[model samples]
Target: MSTVFDFAANLLGGGEKPLADFSGQVLLIVNTASKCGFTPQYEGLEALYRQYGARGFSVLGFPCNQFGAQEPGDSAAIAQFCSLTYDVTFPMFAKVDVNGADAHPLFKFLKGEAKGILGTEPIKWNFTKFLVDRKGEVAGRFAPTTTPKDLEKEIEKLL
Candidate 1:
């Protein structure tokens, strides 16, 4: 059975990071855009990470430019923006294509695991979120309109 751990992504820093590093932890994975209206989600996401990090929960952010060209900056700039603006301390990954032919393998697997509204698999917009349980199985998919605060109960259940 293929899991998200089967794929590896580039860290915002300079190394390849395999999703396997997060094994056994509940994960809230999101495709982010710095310049989009939803960019403020970084604050809520960071709050979730800080609140639950010690309890085997993690929030992973992946910058994606596929929507509205909102994330046109390079990895370093993206990293800096998140840190300076939102004080985001969670793991941020390199820019990736969340849709289309170049979509990262991990995202493809994630979408397959949990389809979005009306069973549509394609991500509708940036800030699309996926919740993964400790066993590395996808638990649920949240739409761009779903705020991070709305996920608290579900996250608590997973923890």
Candidate 2:
């Protein structure tokens, strides 16, 4: 079957990266926006990454502007804001659209793999999360309001 490894994108630091590089690790893929109200969630997300990274878990952050233009900056600006504001150390990808016709192929596949509230596949806002298991299969989808702290148990289960 096709897996996340089949897709590739530009990393925040300017390098081509394939999702396959993350194979065999449980990943918490999140669409982030530095100016959004949920921006504080970065602290919690980073905490999770630090706590579980050694145990085969990672938080992949992707800056997205489809939500109210909350992420209007370029890659460098997004990287600066995330590092300065939240001290995020996890991998960050370039800005991408998470919904509509121009959505990233990886995100489109993710949404198709795990529909959200009431079977909706469209991402409602920034900070929406998708939990992926080691096998690259989607484990669950979390809403923007679902704080990262609340997902510890689920992550623990996967780890």
The TM-score values for the models, in the order shown, are: 0.98, 0.97
Writing each residue's lDDT as its tens digit, candidate 2 over 61-144 gives 999999899999988899988899889999999988889999999899999999988898999999999999998888999999
Across residues 55-148, which tens digit of lDDT does each residue of candidate 1 receive? 9999999999999999999988998899899999999999999888899999999999999889988999999999999999899999988899
**Any runs in candidate 1 off by more than 4 Å, and if so which?**
none
Error of 1 at 35 (Å): 0.6
State the weakest 10-residue window (summed lDDT) of model 1: 2-11
lDDT scores in order: 0.93, 0.92
- The best candidate by TM-score is 1
**Clashing residue pairs for model 2:** none
